[model samples]
Target chain A: MTETPAKPPARARIPLGQRETVAGYLFLLPNMIGFLIFTAFAVVASAAISLTSWDLLSDPEFVGFQNYIELLTDDPLFRTVLWNTFYFTFVSVPVSTALALGLALMFNTGLRAIPLFRAMYFLPVITATVVVALIWRWFFNPDFGILNYVLYELGVDSPPNWLATRTWAMPSVIILSVWKQVGYNMVIFLAGLQAIPTTLYEAASIDGAGRWQRFRNITLPLLTPTTFFVLVISIIGSLQVFDAVLVLTDGGPANATRTIVYHIWEEAFVFLEMGYAAAVAWILFIMVFLVTLLQWKLQKRWVHYEA
Target chain B: MTAHGMNRRRFVLTTAAAGGAAATVANDASASSGAVSSRFHAPAMIGQAQTTLTWAVPGNPDEIAVYESLAEEFMSANPDIAVTLDSEAADFEKFVTLVAAGTPPDIGFATLYNWPSFAERGIFLALDDYIAQDSYDLEDFYEQIITPYRYNGDTFGEGELYGLPKEIAIRAMYFNMDIFEAAGITEMPTPDDVWDWDRFIEMTQQTTIEEGGRTRQYGYVQDVRWTFWQIWAWSAGGDPVDNLYKPTMSTLDNPAVLEGYQVFTDFVTSLGTAPPAAVTADQGHSEMFAAGLAASYNNGRWMVPLFRESDFRWDVMPMPMKTQRAQTLSGSMFGICNGTDNPDEAWRFLSYVVGAEGQTRMTELGLLLPSRKSVAESDLFLNSAPPTNNRIFLDELEFAKPLPLTPIYPELEKVINDQTDLVLIGEKTAAEAVAEMHTQFNALLQGA
Candidate 1:
């Protein structure tokens, strides 16, 4: 005897788009929760703390904008640190970006061993900043440092005390930062270069364009978006330079290399002025925001986007 | 298809909610771990409750081993209490972060300079009650070393005992005997021989050696930092501040202070007796001295262990006197955290560390001068090692003054250090540097 056919299971009635949305949110939930708790919450809390005078141990006292007022009107060190940070960023970012682009162009020759050479150049980016700073500190030593020794051997009677002299301390730091950072930007430039079609260069060559002419007209114009990205990121990174300065100079030889972040750190941790440090942090945020905004606005003038 | 999609969406939404809830549970568990009681119940097998105390200390590997052995001995004696050592270099910022997080170590080590700030902020538990209850003999410690842990009204060293001294440090001159002999100096200055400023300079210049347009050896290398500079200024009958505590004004503009600063700066910028700022900037005073590149190095007892390993002969002598023989007193001390859940257990460990046993162990290590009177005076410390004149550290204790201990000491230090660097580099004269330092320091004090 034939048994009654088993009824087929009924399917769910939800829409595909809704299901996908739920799945997407589930995947993002973990990271979103972390970001909200650690980053977003911390930012808001720091802003609140900035309005109050809190030593780490004592209960915070509400003091409105007193910290900001004092820092702006009375603190001579504040002005000095602010100027030093600006000088570091302005000098390091452009110089490093140019050096990175030049290196990237030289490396993109499609040679048999180009990958090896590129990896060699990218080694510093993978090294720890503390280690790099320490090594550079020794190299910059005026007495037995290899840098000074080499200069002495080259018939130069004396070399500047790179990290100790006021006139040369910031420049020494800038040189170190460039050496440590150029590799990362170079990789980015290489990636950007690879994304550009070789057909454009071929056509230019057929049109009798020389190497310099093609690079100036086609390569540079097309690389504007990448250049803008590099410029913005480099400037932001330079503004927060602390590890190198902390290890190399300790903001010494008369605060020659004391950047804003270092000042904030000393105020917050060393001096135990958490509230003032928070205020300085906010000032830094505003300064970075303005600079980035200016960069975005100015990008339209030169950053060409390919259709 | 529509029904299937709807069911899938519902399932996804449920899963997502469950995941979020699970994450919340996991976060709560992690957060609670910090506050968890470290006591482990063992069904009262030993018929006593077990309590754990965490001690945060900073030292090198050898020192840490010594501490570990001490903990073992402490645990064996006090079986009811378990001790855990948290080894870290003394870092105030990290300590503050731990306190802010509400999980401060039960017992922690703080430098003498930082003890006041910690006490003023109420981070440390005043040990008066504990000391009174235990009848701990505070007089057993050298008054100079223990004075730093006392916090009085608006100043350090008079109010209440918040910490106990772990070790006492006093700065003196460490001379390279070989270098001095090579420079035709047959007789080295002893602790009793009080060299004046002029005599000191002449000896320093004589010890310096130059060859092939480069200095092979420097006569003296002053640290030029605030702590050492204060010693010079004090010996010259001046001080950075009128009072070490509750300082309302800077005494940097005192003529004697200027004279002291001028003498030190001239070593680098004028007399060329010492290595340039550039040279010391890299090699450091200790390294240069140890490497035989300098005839004399100015540092505290902490350099004993480092110098003991050197190939050259060296010894300690009193710092030259400009007006009076003065030395700088600095040290580390152990304090119980105010937020500690186990204050009694912590005090037991803290007392043991700064007690006779602890000081004796440290004396054996020779890294620091013991704070205990018995240990400091006994052959344990006095006859220690290479520095046959270890007595100089104790002999000068009476003259050793604490670095300024105001809450604003760090800020005051930065101002003086920065201005001093300018003087050392020849960018600013002693007069100009001290003038600026005075104005800035006064402002800091007023603001504080």
Candidate 2:
């Protein structure tokens, strides 16, 4: 055995760099495989599809930028949809973010049954969007809706039809989005709030700073990072809003509630214009990327970091 | 970042898992059943195996029973071929979507009104070749039933034909005798005795009365544009859909149609003879007539079933026509799937559905008036009566006109419905609404 060991077979040794590379690749295997199979492939396929006319059957025919051009200029509903989506994103994002931050601050303060309150507030975030949209639809119904009934009790001469009136539809949709979104963002901001040291508030108190002054000086500045994150995420989420709109309004009552995503859906599924829908999808992606980039650029002014 | 990242990761993981689970389910189901697994699956072999064909139909429970019985007979006659009947009451949209998704049954029921749309989308198999080769008895079908299925000027009737009429329904006035009696009305309105706007209003008023300070009854409700258009257009002495595929609402400026619309709208909005806007589609006129809440409702021969179970006596007369004998024709068509793996079997099933024996069986079930002219008029159909007035279908069939055949009819329908609703709701004046409709309709037509 010793003689055999002494004459042991030549040990094969891999180069350190090569070994390290192999290990790194192995570690990244799952994610790389996933990206290749899912994201990258999907993007390429969708882009290719964007140039082709497909009606879910038969072979697709390449139509170049015909779909894009139609969506931009010739499509009658595009401008209306873009404007509605933009309006929804702008109004709902800021209002929802503010409400979320306010709620986070309240919950961050040591309160009894804080976890229970947090869970209750986060309920809507966990509930299905369809169920939420349905509940909101019923609440907004003109004749017998609880909202209108409450308005009636308040002696308002004529409460506006929450989901019906063209003027009220976008606002109602925005209200619903804000309600559904506030919970998730609130939790995120609460985490950020808890992470901030209590010493800052104490230091402000030691300096005889009022509650409003402390909040304006310390809380707002310190919470800026979380606020920026929430703002970006919420705005991006709001822009692509589709499910609720599909279930509730169907972009109806004179196409008042038609969002860009809804238009894309109609083009793809209803009108069987897959190429046009793909183009719309790409356009939406670009718009979201640009908006997020703009937010990132803007964030430098207000976002604060410990480092 | 940690909490949010964790939540995001969990969500992604769960979504992936759910998708995997769904795929697993699909795989398992298909693995067990060859037809489901392969989607475009070929028929399975069991040595010297027999083949089974499937028919997809949209109908009420009674029609499903008729289909099942027909399938039994078909399979019994053709011992080598088995037949499966699948029935769903889901609308044509669902059926079309399912077919487009590539899971179409061997044979299915579709409406002639929607035949062009289906044909354009490639949901249907053209049976011209089969018809020419087989020398099928194409003359047995009613001329009206065959017209809608013909594209490119070729008849493909009954043998995996793109579509053949399963039933025929013609527009008529379905009057509730109970409501008429309550209104103290002795004579019912007939096609020949057309009511002027004033007389129509007076009749609606006399028929519509408030009992105990709540409006318990309605005299009439304005029908939707499709049904109402025929009456108004024929009254105005114009066709509903012109040869140019334009809505004859432009022709509504004609005194007769204008008067017809005025009378109709007044009966609903002005005379309080119709239900509110909320239930107008499903529960307005026809449902009111069924519930003994309306003296008269304008519908079609198709809706006699509402009175089948009703305690009150009911009857259908020819819809009051203004100029010519007018009735809007609407009916379902039986067609084979274009992408069916087994066209031979599908054609066999189609032949049975559109053939004399199949039509007689369908008639006997009282689900519909058969498309075969002979079957429709046969002692078989005339004698098999649930309401005891099966002859009304034949009477109305003579005046029936198939709705306009256009691929863009759905979009046109939306536009027309919107305009009609606006005019009815008094949101827009009839002239303004019709003008708007013309503009919108022309735009849609051009786009299509």
lDDT of 1 by residue, B417-437 (tens): 788788877789888998898
Which candidate ranks first by TM-score, i.e. highest? 1
**TM per prediction:** 0.90, 0.72
Clashes of each: 11, 0
> What's the lDDT for residue B1 in model 1?
6
Model 2: native contacts recovered, as a fraction: 0.03
Cα lDDT of model 2 by residue, B157-241, tens digit:
2233467677675655667766777778788654345455456556667887675434656676545555566565565465534
Give candidate 2 misplaced runs (Cα > 4 Å): A1-42, A52-61, A99-137, A161-164, A179-182, A186-211, B1-46, B49-109, B120-123, B128-143, B153-161, B167-235, B244-327, B353-398, B417-427, B439-448
RMSD of 2: 8.8
Q: Cα miss at B318, model 2 (Å)? A: 6.9
Write down the lDDT of every candidate, Cα atoms only.
0.80, 0.66
Q: What's model 1's TM-score?
A: 0.90
- For each model in turn, which proportion of the native inter-chain contacts is also found? 0.55, 0.03
User: Which residue segments of model 1 deviate by more than 4 Å?
Assistant: A1-14, B1-48, B88-90
